[model samples]
Target: MVFLVCLIFCFLAPALEAQVAVRDTVLTVRPGDSLLAIAHRLLRYSTEYTAGELVDRIKRENGLQGDAIQMGQLLDVSLSYAELLDQPVIRGTNFAARGIYITAALAGSRRMLTLADALVAAGGNTVVFDVKDRYGNLGYASSVPLALEIGAGQRAPIAQPAKMLDALHRRNIHVVARLTCFYDARLARQRPDFVPFSREGPGLWSERGKSNWVDPSLPQVQEYLLAIVREVAELGVDEIQLDYVRFPTEGNLADAVFAFDPAVVPKDRIITDFVTEVERVLEPMGVLLSADIFGVAAWGREADRRTIGQHLPDLLPHLDAVSPMLYPSHFEDGFERIDRPVDYPYYFLLQGCQRLQKLATEHDVLVRPWIQSFDYRVTDFDSLYVTEQLHGAEDGGARGWLLWNPASLYEIGFAAIKGFTDSTAATVPVKLRFPKSLGMDLTRPTSVAD
Candidate 1:
């Protein structure tokens, strides 16, 4: 009899453990259902409860920690909701196979919709929005006094940052905040000492003729950017993508000079210091940090490092991900050998990403290359080229990619990718594939990048 009981107990344990106490329910609150009303309705059959008692019970039931409900949030009021009230809710980070950028202004203004609407238009799932722009302007009003002082505070055309985040979180869309670092014209003019200046002259700026850029060497510069990163962190952004992380590259090198005091620091040290400081601030917060490096840097040559101050091995340690700007037009002659660099987008993009993949593998860092979505000097930017580049990035072993169109307009390129069918709904998954002919590794690295 004792042996029979033990066998029964063993058989029942697995089934009990497998059973989830709460069913996966998506409750849509009707227009008339108040917090109290819903509770009374769900508990009407219970003999001991009054309607008034049911209302309070319902508030407790739905794990409505606060007495509030939005118009149409599909609440997951399962048995777990009550137990998980104080804990940080974990949401999915599944991004769409193809994603696009939406300016904060556009996202807020006429294009504004329930977080659902915006996701559907871009083929759904992932959103890359501007938290801070090239001009150092914040998309939403900020609590930081320095942000407001520099005119960084502006209402995101979308109006509600928290509400938007909650909506997107519910839909499982990965939200990435694009923060433009070092390219602040407004702050540069306001704080001239923080800007990079030419060593040739007391007042000369770099050749890009852009008079703005925070001196990367300044400790205060890193502090200022960290302040912004922290503010966005509180909003629950999945990732913080640092743009313009490099020194000014297009300017006349002969005339243009770095203002960072050489007696105090070395050039390579300055770049790494800024990245390390940013990582130091962000690491404790548990946020993913990524930096954009010029495509040429992946080649691991001295000239590339001199031009952009970006050394792959040096930067790999400080970043969770590195995005190389592999836009074909940005390459020089003999890249893919199609005569005009613009004419041969696929060749340069594929080769550039392949080289970057190899370099990143050596360093053991994640590579997510930025692909060209717009036509530069050439006029033929169709679906075929866009798909080809996407395939190339995947083939080169990149985890994912970002499409670049300075104007924020994306249509033909988005349509070209396969697997996704819904273009009018809020969130949907799209499938993508890398051709078998091209070899790349998708596995996580066993060792960290140097």
Candidate 2:
């Protein structure tokens, strides 16, 4: 009987070893903690397991078919070497990559070479091509009938949008689709009844006599933008960035009017409602949704409340990342102790970024600032000045930064920034210049030194 029992125990031991044991562990879901974060922490303890492998184990044990771990939810985690080895491999974040913006015409033509040359000159590792511009036009051919009816679809300079994405992906270059929302002039024009007009009549919404925007309070407008976003997601792009998400700023406010329906809701609820709806439709699609807010929004102080109705807390929950347009040239007087706003670019940029970073941490969102890369007010483009802005963003605890040169010219500015090598066959390594105190534990939340 003893020999038989030993034989049974030996056979069962192998099976038991393959199975994971559940154990309770205390974990504080820090700001920015996601389902991926929890898996990453567990894999750190189990040397043989990676985050992806541990995620599979956690899902199997928890009876989860999808990734949706909530903040502060205590999870039971365990893993085995054999199970881990069978799991999928995870990719590392490309920290040094910078994003570039390209227009539909440029992306489609052999002028793509010019754009590529510009990217190479600027040390850019990512390209954000416009799938839909402010006109609400699709850069590529669309199957959506509304897109055809409204004349919103186009066969871009690039024969196929998917081919462009695939080429970028092959180069290990991250591609983001820029979908301009709310300020869609084309849609508003076609459907004048849906346009936000002055109290006078059914006319177009104009800002500064240069651009026109759609009414945010309109449900039909929201649906149109969502359809474009869905089309971009299906293009196999890495991320979809929503530009002009807010109301038009520099316009005739007193003369301007809203076609906003009083029956549907209140004015305060309009912006938040639109953002929430967009997130709800986009989140489960396995793509990231990012929104651009004014630099002042990051201050958490309602400075431009009337024009740019963006409040930090309101927009935080609806986004994967928040990019504040911290262009120093745009600020008014008395910012960063500079009597002349444009003269002190570095100082204002640093201070503004710091404020924005603080707001991002409080709301548990990632900060990726749009820094000034072009010389607007200044007669000469300063390379060292650009480096200072980069330092400022890094000092303020930005995860990554992007340079904005409207014409795609960035030779001087890129040369000045540290850690970027020139576009040549034999390149020299340049040390990345980051503030020592601004150390980012890629696996953990950001913290400012006390």
Candidate 3:
């Protein structure tokens, strides 16, 4: 199939290439400059090019053989300043995305229809649902060969993915397939050679004692992930957002062992190479790719990033956007010297956004944080509480924000964004209906009154 596309692209290549203006701006390399550093320094949030993309252009133009750049060396950048800030819309939405997270369970349920209506009515244009969840389960039936080989699709939660896509796509929602790449219990159990290990045993690397990760260092694991990505892209989803794309974050990290390529490739490189390959393969499919990273990752913490194998700069070259899980409740008490980070969502989130934007924007990548929507730190989380975090994200210059509600509950969330409704007068539909054409079980208790 890809071969056919390549053949067509080759024939139309000249005409397609003609559409690009191919602008250039020159810069002299400074003392501390490398190709990557230059890319980060000059690249901006623009549809014209990603930082790595422009850097690639610079290399091609300058006829460079390696990453080596000396001080006073002249380089030509293919993007102008104006082009750097221009945000071209994808599926009719800007990089400044406003959306929410829906779990695999709720995605397959009837509630999503009403929730979809509520989201659309609330002026949100984007929605992200699960395709593959953290538990190593395929949320929907996958055309990927490996998924079927391993029985990952057995008793799938989302039986009618095409139908669900139709329902959501009809509402003009930008659907992103959320796939957990490395944190897969199913994949680990089925392919023990693909999982992390230690002297302790199979479950040596885990979060909270649940070590079910498919090691990123394994080439076999990457192949499986690529297959899943290709299948998801074919599902007509707008974007692919990888969750848990990092290494195991919990339990006996010091003793954990990788079955392949250990002590050779750096953790960050492993993650970057994996994501880079996924992006390379899927870009032709017209699906945008993004990865969820730890909130501290945006700050470029060496230890933090190395631990998770997700360095913001390394990932920037390969993704459409990077979403940091900035749930304030997840932070520690001594975070940034704030004794109680939970009590100060605004402080931590705002700070996180500031640093994150600095790191992400330089690479021509955008930051869309997963802000706290569910009650965790605030026992009395109200509209104002949620509002503060939302505003903080905006104030810190986040391109967009996505609200995370684990149980699919969003009462305070809705109340907080009441003004988003187009009509001032209160009105609600008596019953919400899913598209019967999708062949879903229509019998569902309604909570989201349209």
Point to the candidate with the largest lDDT: 3
- RMSD (Cα, Å) of model 2: 18.2
- Between candidates 1 and 2, name the one with more favorable lDDT: 2
**C-alpha TM-scores of all predictions:** 0.68, 0.68, 0.71
What lDDT score belongs to each candidate, Candidate 1 first? 0.61, 0.62, 0.70
Provide backbone clash counts, one per model. 2, 2, 1
Q: Sort every candidate by TM-score, greatest first.
A: 3, 1, 2
What is the lDDT, from 0 to 100, of the residue 353 in candidate 1? 62
Q: After superposition, which runs of candidate 3 have C-alpha atoms over 4 Å from their true positions?
A: 1-89, 200-210, 260-262, 419-450
Q: What's the true lDDT of residue 324 in model 1?
A: 79
lDDT of 1 at 439: 37
For model 1, residues 1-450, the per-residue Cα lDDT tens digits are 432343334333332311323323346777865766655444322211233444555456567776578767555432211111111234323222245667887554434344345445545555678888887778777887677776667544444465455545555566678888878776787677777667676884754777767777677777788888888887777778888887776667656556555436656677777788778877787777788888767666687676566766777778877887888777765542334565554544555567676656666667777878788865666765666667667656776677777766666645643322332322211222211122343221212221
lDDT of 2 by residue, 239-266 (tens): 7788887777666765567765533654
